[model samples]
Target: MTAYILLEIRRTLRDTTFLVFGTGMPVLMYLLFTNLGGGGDHDEWKAYSMVGMAAYGALASAMAIGTGIASDKSLGWLQQLRITPLAPGRAVTGRAISGSVTVLPTILAVLLAGALGNGVRMAAWQWIALVLLLWAGALPFTLLGIGNGYRLTPQATGVVNVACLMGLAIVGGLWFPITEFPQWLRSIGEFTPAYGFAELGRSVVAEHAPAAGAPAVLAGWLLLFGGYAVFSYRRSARTA
Candidate 1:
């Protein structure tokens, strides 16, 4: 299991596109936005952009980790692993572990970009808490990506990933606050994982407060996706 996880990490790090999308794009967006706003001490704008960039990082991480798994499965890598001594659960565990490992660098890159370029500031403890909250808030999407990758064909998985990211970014206040959105849009945002994550990140970094109902919402979605992953894995095993 450790060997497999190490191999996965190595392959992921070697992927140039993954590095670019996972870290480069968020930093680029942060720089661009900061430049546009004159890079001032506008606390509200700083907070909003910081949270949004963190949410964007989460989305990017989900797509990379999830799609990599799906692509591997489609390429028969996972099938080969299944034929090995590793149990199905252990194999899944390795993937999750590797995903978490890959996600950390992206998270740090986003935070640093915001701090250095956008003038967002937090104490060391706050920074640690913010990282924890961001990861916690992202759990649902990560799990959803796993479930989707496990269930869908590689081509369809790509489409689903694109749709999910775009949909969430648009409706979840990453582009703008839910308050600025139409009533129906705000209603939709209220129920989304992205919204919960965005609010949680903002609360932690900007408000210096605990995430508001983020744990509950994330827990619900986590359960939902955890169930989906199990069911899909079982179905796939049976079919195979």
Candidate 2:
């Protein structure tokens, strides 16, 4: 399991495209948007944009696990793995861990952009807390990716992954504040896991306790995605 996790991490890091788009794009977006905005509270808006872009990058990184899984399945790597000692559940868990690991660079890149480029400021502990919260918050997305990998073809997985990211970003207010949305859209965004994940980090920046609903919504998604991932993995294993 440890070896597999390491291998997955290595593979993920070697994908130059993933590194560019997953980490670079978010930082670029943050820089562009922060510069363009003429806001009432500049620091607060910068911090909010920082968190949103970081969360989006993390989301892209975590969900790419599904596309990798689909590719592995197509290549019969998953079937080959069945002969190994690693349990099916552990395989999924390992992938999830690796997927989560991929989010670190994205988070850091956005943090640096916020601090150095845009003058977004926070306490030392708040920075640490924000990183940890955002990283931990990516678990549900990883599980969702795993489930999608087991269920879709590689081509379909790629398409669906991008669609999911776009939908989540738009609906969860990652591109802007939820308050800017119409009341109906705001209500819907509040319920999404993306919103919850970003809110967790935003709470640290805001120097306040997060609303209970944020963590609660995240927990609910984690449970749902986890169960789906397990079922998908086991089903794939059996069929393979």
Candidate 3:
């Protein structure tokens, strides 16, 4: 299992696709927004922007990790694993672990950009809490990717992932403050995984109690995605 996880991580790192979407694009977006003076002169606003960008980076990376399962299945990696002693579910588990591992770099990049580029400041506890929450909040997307792997073709994976990710991020106010959106739009954004995830990240730096509803929302999404992944895996296993 250890060896398999290592192999998966190394393979993902080698491809560089993950790095582009996960780390580079998010950092670029952060720089672009801040360079335009998105954070403005307020420290609190800087913290808000910083947390949002970090959340965006983390979310994008997580989506990349989850959706890439389609590519792996298409490339016969699953079949290759069948000859080994890894459990049926372990393949997805390995990818989930890899996603968590890969997300660290993106988080760091966003945090540094927030601090150095945008002049945001956070205490040590705030930093730790933000990172921890972002990482934990990624579980839904990790499950989402595993579930998607079973149903989506490699050809459609890229389109689906990018569209879904961007849509959720935008609607959830990661791109802009949710407060600025129309009331109807904000209502819808509240239901998206991004809303809960990003809001949770925001709570860390803002030194507020996390949202009362975010955990429940996250739990619901995780359960739904995980159940789908299990069903899809069983069907695929039978077909194989």
Candidate 4:
């Protein structure tokens, strides 16, 4: 298990594209949207803008991590891997670990930008809570990607990844607040995992607790995605 996980982590580290998309792009977006605060109490501004930017970073992490499985399938690497002693479900387990590991750099980079580039600040507990929440919240996106890989081809997976990132950003209210959108759009955003995920991080700073439905919605998606991930691996193992 350790060897497999280490191998995946090493491979993930070597993915320059992953580094750029997951970390570079998110930091770039943070700089572009610092004014997202639109002038308010400094702490609140930091909280709002930081949450928005971090949400996008989280989106990138999820897409990059999830898409690799589909890419490997298209290349026949998954079949090749089966000849090894690595157990059937272990591949998926490694991928989930890789996905989580890759998300770390993106999360750290955005946090740095929020602190330095935008002067975002908070209580010690708030900082710890927000970071921990975002890190833990990223798991759902990884699972979503795994489900996608099982159902789609590599080419289609790539397209869907980009679409998911952009669509989620727009609808999840990461690029901007859902409140700024029309009532219909806002209603739509409420159902997205992006919204649920972002709102979880925001809770650390916001005066109010998250909506009761947010965690429930996230958990529901997680279960759906996790089911597919397990089923996909088992099906592929049988075929292999």
Top of the candidates by lDDT: 2
| Model 2: colliding residue pairs | none
**Better structure of 3 and 4 per lDDT:** 3
lDDT of 3 by residue, 111-169 (tens): 88888887888788888888888888887877776676766777676677778778888
Model 1 alpha-carbon drift over 4 Å, by segment: 1-4, 37-41, 182-185, 237-240
lDDT of every predicted structure (CA atoms): 0.73, 0.86, 0.76, 0.76
Summarize candidate 4's per-residue lDDT along 22-93 as a digit string, tens digits.
688878877775665366546667667777777668767776665678777767776777778877667666
Sorted by lDDT (best first), the order is 2, 3, 4, 1
User: Which candidate should be chosen as best, given TM-score against the real structure?
Assistant: 2
TM-score of each: 0.85, 0.90, 0.86, 0.83
In model 2, where do residues sit more than 4 Å from their true spots? 37-41, 180-188, 238-240
Q: What's the count of clashing pairs in each model shown?
A: 0, 0, 1, 0
The residue pairs in collision within model 4 are: none
| Superposition error at 13 for model 2 (Å) | 2.5
The residue-by-residue lDDT of candidate 2 on 84-189, one tens digit each, is 8888778888889988867888899999999999888789999999899999999999899878998789999988888887898788887778999999999999
For candidate 2, give the lDDT. 0.86
What is candidate 4's CA lDDT for residue 168?
A: 75
